[model samples]
Target: MHAGPRPSILFVTDLAYPARGRRYCDEDIFLTSRLREEFDVALCHPRDAAALLDGFDAVVVRNSGPVLHYQEAYDAFCARARERKVPVYNPLTGRGDMAGKQYLVDLSAAKYPVIATVDRAGDLGLLPGAAEYVIKPKLGADSVGLRFVTPDALAAEVGAEPDGSVLVQPRIDFRYEVSFFFIDRDFQYALYAPHPEQRWVLEPYEPTTADLAFARRFVEWNDLAHGIQRVDACRTADGDLLLVELEDLNPYLSLDRVTDEVREAFVARMKTSVRALLH
Candidate 1:
C-alpha cells in the first residue's frame, strides 16, 4: 500500500521506442493520462522498472518494446517482482507472446486454429505446404528477425538455424488482418487492416460470431485470468481466421482507431482490472 492513500501504479513504457507505423509514446501518454485520474501513476522505462517497482503497489507493463531488446534487464525485473511478491498487473501468468512464440508451436500441435508452426526442419512435413514459408526467431516481436523463404530455401534456412531457435509457418494468403483487444477476459474492441500490405493503417472492425469465436479460442487457451491480450489473426483466402499471434505482454491497443465511446469503455475496463488487481 502507498504511504498516502491511492494504490500507486508504476506504468512501464518506452516512450522513445520507434515503430514503423505505430506511435508508442502516444498510446502510453493517452493511457497514463487517463489512468492518473484514478490511481497514482508514474511512467518508467522498462529497464528502470526493477529498481523503481518497489516504490509502487503494482506494475503495469505496456508497450515496453520487445523483450528481445532488453532481455537481461526485463529478466531482472521479472525476477525481482516475483521475489518481492509484487502484484504485477499482468500477474506474470501470461503464456502467449509474453513468454515467447513457443505457444504458437504448442497451439498448432494441439490442432488449435493458429497458423501451423514448427521448429525443426524435419517437422516441415507436419505443416501444410505453401509456396513460401515464414521463419522467425522463437523469441521475436515487432517483426524483428522475421523472414520469408521459398520452399527450396526453407529447408536450408531452417536447417542452418538451430532447432527451436526459430519458428516456421506457411505464409498464408489472407484477405486482411484483425486484432481483438481484451481487458482481462472481457472483449473491448477490434481493429482490422483492410489492406494486407498496409498492416498498420487500421479501421474499426465488426467481428462476426465465428470471428469472435476464432479469436476467443486463443484468449481462452492462454489461461490468464487478467491482463490485456490482443488476438491478432489473418482472415485467410478461404474465409477462416487463423491466429497470427497472441499478444498478452503489452499489446498495442491502437486506441486512436476506435470511437471515443469504445475507447472510454476500454479505459474503464482497464481501470477496473487494475483496481481489482490492487485490492
Candidate 2:
C-alpha cells in the first residue's frame, strides 16, 4: 500500500457551469463538503487538471462538463495523467461515453437493444426504419448540437469524419427514462423520471431483480473498479430497457432527490471506494 494521509485528492469540477434543469454547482459543493472530512481535497476546473494533478495522490473528476467544449485542455490533462501515472477516478480508459459515441454503433451492431446508430452516410441504411433521427456530435455532452431530422434529409447532412465528428441515431419512442447509479461497480440507489418531458424531475425507484441484473450488465461492461457511474436507459413502448447512455465521467448524483437513508448509504459507499483507491 502507498503510505500517506488518506490520499490527497484533486477533485475536478466547474461549479459555475450552467446546466439546464440541474444545479451543477450545488451538487459539487455538497459532495466536496462531505469528502473533505476524510480527504485532503482541492477543487479545480478540467482545464487546470494537467498542471495540478502531479501534486495529488489521486484525481477525482466530478461534474467537469463536456470535454468537447475544452478539447485541448482535456487532451493535455489526459496525456499528462497517463505520462505521470497519476490515478484518476473513473480512470482515463473508460470505453463508454468517456471515449466517444462510437460505442453506440458498436453496441447496436452487436444487437444490444440500444438505439440504432450510424456514424457515416453509407451506414445510414443500416439504421432501423424510424420517422425521425437524432443527430449529435460523437464527443458531445449535455445534448449539445442535438437535432431531429427526417431520414430523407440525412443523406445531405451526414459527413465523413472519423474524429468523432457526428453520430446518427433514431429518436426512440420510449415511455420514460431511468438511471441506475453505481460506486466502484457496486449498485447504489436508483431514481427515475416518470414523465418523459421533465427529465430532471426524479423520484425514488426500487429496481426489481431483473432491473438490477440489466443495470449490472452495463456496469460490468464498463469495468471501472473506482469512482461512480450512472447507467441511463429508456423504457420502450414494449416494456424493454434500452441503453441511452452510460455516464462514467462525473455523472451528477442527484443526491438531493433521494431519501436521507439512501443519500447516507451512497456517501458511505463512496468513502469506502475512495479509501480502497488509496492503496
Candidate 3:
C-alpha cells in the first residue's frame, strides 16, 4: 500500500483517562512498546485518530476509554475508517459489550446464561427477584453512574421515564468473579479475584472443562475475528458461572498478571495477527 516494508499502525489510547481500579495507560504503554518490534507504530489519543488514520495501514484501538466522552470524534473515525477501508482491530463486528450492553438484553431474551438485564420500564419483571437491583447507563463503561436500589425505589425510578438512559439487573450475589481471556477466538488464559471487593488482585486460574465450555460459548457468540476478548463472569453461590460482560472492544489484557512466557507468547501472537491485517 505505502510501498514500505513495515506495516504502520495508529495505536489509539487515552493515557489520561482516570480509570478506577485500573491503570489504562500503563497497559497500553507496555503493549505499544512491545509492538514497536514488528511495526512502525505511533500512539495517539482517541480524539485524534480520524485525522491521522489515513496514513497508517491499520488502527489498533486500545485503552481509549469510553467512546461516550468523544462520540462525535469516534463516530467520525469509524465512518472514515469504513469509507477508506482501514482495518480496525477487533474488526468492529463484535456483538458484546463492545457494541453496548444492549447485547446483554438481547442474549437474555434469547435465554442465554447472562445475568438478566432490561432497559425499559415495562421489562423489569424479566429480571430475577432480589432484595436490590443494579441500575446503570446502558452505554456505560468503568462502572460509571451505577447504582443499587430497592425494588420499590427501582419501580419509581423506572416510572420517571429517565430519558431511557439506564439498564437494570438483579444484584447477583456471587461468590467471586473470573475472566476468560481470548485472542481471536483462541483461549489464552483465565484469571480470578478471590475477593469480590479486591477486583484488581488477580491470580492465574485453572478452569474446569465445564468452566471453559461456559466461557467459550460467549467468545463464540461475539464472533470477533482478530482481537483480544475477555469474558467476565461471576460464580453463583452454587459454583456455576454466569456471563457478566463480554469485553471485545479494547479488552485490557492484564498482561502484568501473567507469567513472562505467557505474556511473550501473547505479544507474539498479537504481532502476527496485526501483521495479517495488513492485507
Specify the highest-TM-score model's number.
1
TM for every model, in the order presented, reads 0.98, 0.95, 0.96
Off by over 4 Å in 2: 1-4, 159-164
RMSD (Cα, Å) for all candidates, in order, is 0.9, 1.9, 1.3
lDDT scores of the candidates, listed in order: 0.91, 0.87, 0.88
Better candidate number, 1 or 2, judged by lDDT: 1
What would the per-residue lDDT of candidate 3 be over residues 1-279, giving only the tens digit for each residue?
455888888999999999777788998999999999888889999999999999988999999998888989988998999999999997878888767888888888999888898888889988888999999887898887799999989888776755667888999999999999988778888999999999888899999999999999998888777888999999999887889999988887788899998898889888988877766
User: By summed lDDT, which 10 consecutive residues of candidate 1 come out lowest?
Assistant: 155-164
* Each model's total of backbone clashes: 0, 0, 0
Q: Which order, best to worst by TM-score?
A: 1, 3, 2
Worst 10 residues of 3 by lDDT: 156-165
Ranking by lDDT: 1, 3, 2
- Relative to the true structure, candidate 3 reaches a TM of 0.96
Kindly list the per-residue Cα lDDT of model 1 for residues 150-195, writing each as its tens digit. Answer: 9999888888986578999999999999999887788889999999
- TM-score of candidate 1 against the unseen true structure: 0.98
Better of 1 and 2 by TM-score: 1
